[model samples]
Target: MKMFLSHLDSPLGTMLLVTDDRQVVRALDFADHKAHLHRGLREHYGEVVLAEILPPVGIVGALVRYFAGELEALNELPTQTAGSDLQRRVWGALRRIPAGSTTTYGKLAKELGFDDPRAAIDIGAANGANPVAIIVPCHRVIGSNGDLKGYAWGLHRKRWLLEHEKAMKPAKEEGRTAMLPGF
Candidate 1:
């Protein structure tokens, strides 16, 4: 299968977006992680054939809107990734995490039906292997103590994304407040 590739310039840094012929996003990672991206693609799909094209406008637009404070813009974009059943389940749960909220690995593991704390290590590994970055929302996972933890894109970018989402959260609430009958 031929993989379509494109570059997106984001606030944190440049990102490489990979999609299939049908335009379902397969991977999105920082441009600096080219080697990591290639390794992941090779592992997931042996012998990837890459072709460059303009980024999918709808997906890129959604990301742009997300960075511009419209956090829900990313909610509707389509994605496709190759992974184990556990990894796919973990990634799906990651998307359900609210934009401004963080969940610990233990919490996520429990949510996925794992009651033991050791399950968190497996959960963390799945999070680390998430193919799509911001769209999958893996950055929202943190340590049990609420410390920012591992993010494939780097902790600095993780901090920035969380802060950006948090800052936008108030604006959403304020908008709701303004529409209420009483000030």
Candidate 2:
């Protein structure tokens, strides 16, 4: 398996891109070094894909396009993601969250037809486990209190993603738009 990292210019600052020979495995908010990010990759991919070698810049380019709102669906880039069946369900649900929109965990739980918040919390855990970042749009899920919470990358990046999507979403009517808690 091939592995590499690249610097991406984004509204959230420089981000790290990690990929295997087939598809992207991880995209992280910038860190001083790659060592801190290797544990997860090592656990997920074994020794096949190591972080010592940074991935090609093109991998990062795709992410840049995504964050810029130039690319809508992210099935183009290859991603080798592993998760439980329930987690997969949650991830799939997350993809349907529209651009410039936010959904509460409780609401998502209801949409999933579960009356309990624990089920939604399970989905949230899976969302947090997601290796492919912005593409899956896990950042779209927020606390029922309307606060951003529990982003593996960091809360700042989560806030940035939400604001970025809000900025990208087209205006619906004149002088009137959906307002978010922090945006």
Q: How do the predictions measure up, each by TM-score? A: 0.90, 0.71
Error of 2 at 107 (Å): 2.9
The lDDT leader among the candidates is 1
Residue pairs clashing in model 1 are none
Count of backbone clashes, every candidate in sequence = 0, 5
Model 2 residue 170 lDDT? 33
Tens digits of lDDT, candidate 1, 105-154: 99999999999899999999999999999999999998988788888888
lDDT of 2 by residue, 1-183 (tens): 557665555655556667655545554545533554566566555674544555565565666677657656354565555566776677778878876788877787788788887877776777787766777778889988777779887776676677666623433446775433344
Worst 10 residues of 2 by lDDT: 27-36
Residue 149 of model 1, lDDT score: 84
Please give the distance, in angstroms, between residue 93's alpha carbon in candidate 1 and its true position after superposition. 0.5
What is the alpha-carbon lDDT of model 1 when measured against the actual structure? 0.88
- Pairing residues by index, what is the TM-score of model 2? 0.71
The runs of at least 3 residues in candidate 2 whose Cα sits more than 4 Å from the true structure, single-residue gaps closed, are 24-29, 32-36, 51-58, 69-75, 167-183
